[model samples]
Target: MARLQLRNLEKDYGGFKAVHGINLDVADGEFMVLVGPSGCAKSTTLRMIAGLERVTGGEIRIGDSLVNDKAPGERGIAMVFQNYALYPHMKVRKNLSFGLRLKRRPAEEIEQATRDVSNILEIGDYLERLPKQLSGGQAQRVAVGRALIKKPQVFLFDEPLSNLDAKLRASMRVRITDLHKQLKADGLQSTVVYVTHDQTEAMTMGDRICVMKEGRIMQVADPVTLYNRPANAFVAGFIGSPEMNLIDADLSGSTLSIGSQSLALGPAMLERLNPKAASALTFGVRPQHFSLVGAGEDNALEGRVSHVEFMGHEVYLYVNVEGQQMIVVVSATAYDRSKIQGDIVRLQPSQETAHLFDRKTGENVSLADLH
Candidate 1:
């Protein structure tokens, strides 16, 4: 396995810079995922690592060797693309053996490697079938097998599960993670760099996830840290399922005024806020962090129920608080069925979980204590 490093890596398309100077380190045998929305340069960064795209500046290192000038084939990295990228005319056996064949490995070694990969992927039955004959998931497995057979120092996946259906994608996520573990157990090179726009995939698969935006790295942390202790406003809003509610507000002492209404920032939260936080800041809280409270609750924000969505055991309550929309998740059993649209409700934000951010910079000012 190899430890991958990108130091001040950059890429530009003539006049436009697609990747900013971003530095990241992927430890040997680690699964590092680069995730962000479309046009975030995640794919560009992955391509740079794989030597598929030329870096305009900075260093690309695999293990102890600098590989910025190396060809893709010489980088000791194997890449699995979004599309299977398999030769349609080639049977699975040939496709998996193509890399080894190009190197002119022994015929006996190629045959043994093919069998081993096929068994591990459980695609042994379709070894003789053409790429057209396999299902989306099956074809993806073959693609992974092709890379696996190379025994490269690192594995790079560019949204490898995007072409599959939801169910298939879920299954493939587990399969790939398990395969990485199995390979590691067998003393094989199992370092992986996965690029995807899907937050679910990143949260579930990565040992540590790097969130990016506008060609820059936002935050790199484990899933729990990303969720519970987001470093900034962008990350606070992006990593959650329903996404965190980021409302514009004016902070005064220990109170936040949103439109015509105001909520008190409790002592616990006030203590954590950075002293330099601007008066104009964002009030960030997740749907799950808000609780349904009585109408006269002291610190609760009053609003009218704009909509209600019953999601099995949980209900998503959409409220319009002084012209600002906020979502609160409550247990189905606890939610008042009699309360419908237009009904007034009080939503209380959790003091420990609520975040305050600088309006201009999107910096989570309330994260001073978290670090």
Candidate 2:
């Protein structure tokens, strides 16, 4: 329900900067996700937004208010931690109603709010149960319910599903997204800021994903845009499931030479390239974009199959192109398992799906002008 803005937000610990100067504006009622690997400053940023960690510099604003100097409770924000953070001695009902009780709300109002949150989260049956008696999923629901009862202007989640099993994580993801939609449908301000290391969660849950690395923002875009038109090689390699294969190649005029093979570039690619400069570039192709081709096919990279992995409907082939290893995905039904390791195969990358990045800076050269 609130627009969140972090202007030049920074966090430093004893001269060591954990978060650099990063700027972002989250629209009102938007679901934003911060995704990256470990030690990427995602949790630190979330904590700063929640007023749990003091900012080293810059400002943290919620709606029209400057909340940099406000305490966590006064900032009108509720947070759900990764570990559930439930009080072991308190029952589910007490845990959910604790915040309201501290504010000294009326008894009937607290009861009604607790009931509403319990019904929304489907944890009404465990109202009398303690945290120790509940399953991991149930405990997580209580933790979220605790935050929901507050009805804060902004919600912050710090890897809230990391402790659950794979199936539970998927189920919880759907539940959380549905909850967000329901809140929006009911005309409530339910802006959310979620932090997760899993790209799957970021892709499915976020309206816009902010990809971070080494305490800096890399790229922020919708899931499809980030996948199809990555801003840089780091974003391209980090967002995809079977990460994009980046191969070193030489660029000359309208042709790209990968290893000993040369592939002609299309007009669109030629327009994106620097015609006067023939330099070393990184050619990126996704696994699914590579197709099987005959030995005599043009624009094909010939390589020996180094390994084969069957993944239900699709198979991933690990091919060795000279000294470099590349992965190609093919339908399991169409692939011949008999041709295993050491088998020679030719893969032709789709020209339209190929990505070109500057070798020196790791920036996507193809998208330089567009972005």
Q: Give the top-scoring candidate (TM-score).
A: 1
> Which candidate number maximizes lDDT?
1
When superposed on Cα atoms, how far off is each prediction in RMSD? 1.3, 1.7
Each prediction's number of clashing residue pairs: 0, 3
- Tens digits of per-residue lDDT for model 2, 1-371: 49999999999999899999999999988999999999999999999999889999999999999999999999999999999999999999999999999999999999999999999999999999999999999999999999999999999999999999999999999999999999999988799999999999999999999999999999999999999998888999999889999999988877788878888888767766544333788899999999887756787888998888989999999998867899999998878644433498888898777889888878888864665
- Residue 322 of model 2, lDDT score: 66
| Global Cα lDDT for candidate 1 | 0.92
Per-residue lDDT of model 1, residues 1-371, tens digit only: 49998999999899899999999999999999999999999999999998888899899999999999999999899999999999999999999999999999999999999999999999999999999999999999999999999999999999999989999999999999999999889889999999999999999999999999999999999999999888899999999999999999999988889988888888878889898889999999999998787755688888888788999999998888877898899998889754433488878889899888889999889977754
Tell me the TM-score of model 1: 0.97
Query: What TM-score would each prediction reach against the true structure?
Result: 0.97, 0.96
Candidate 1 clashes between residue pairs 3 or more apart in a chain or in different chains: none
Error of 2 at 47 (Å): 0.6
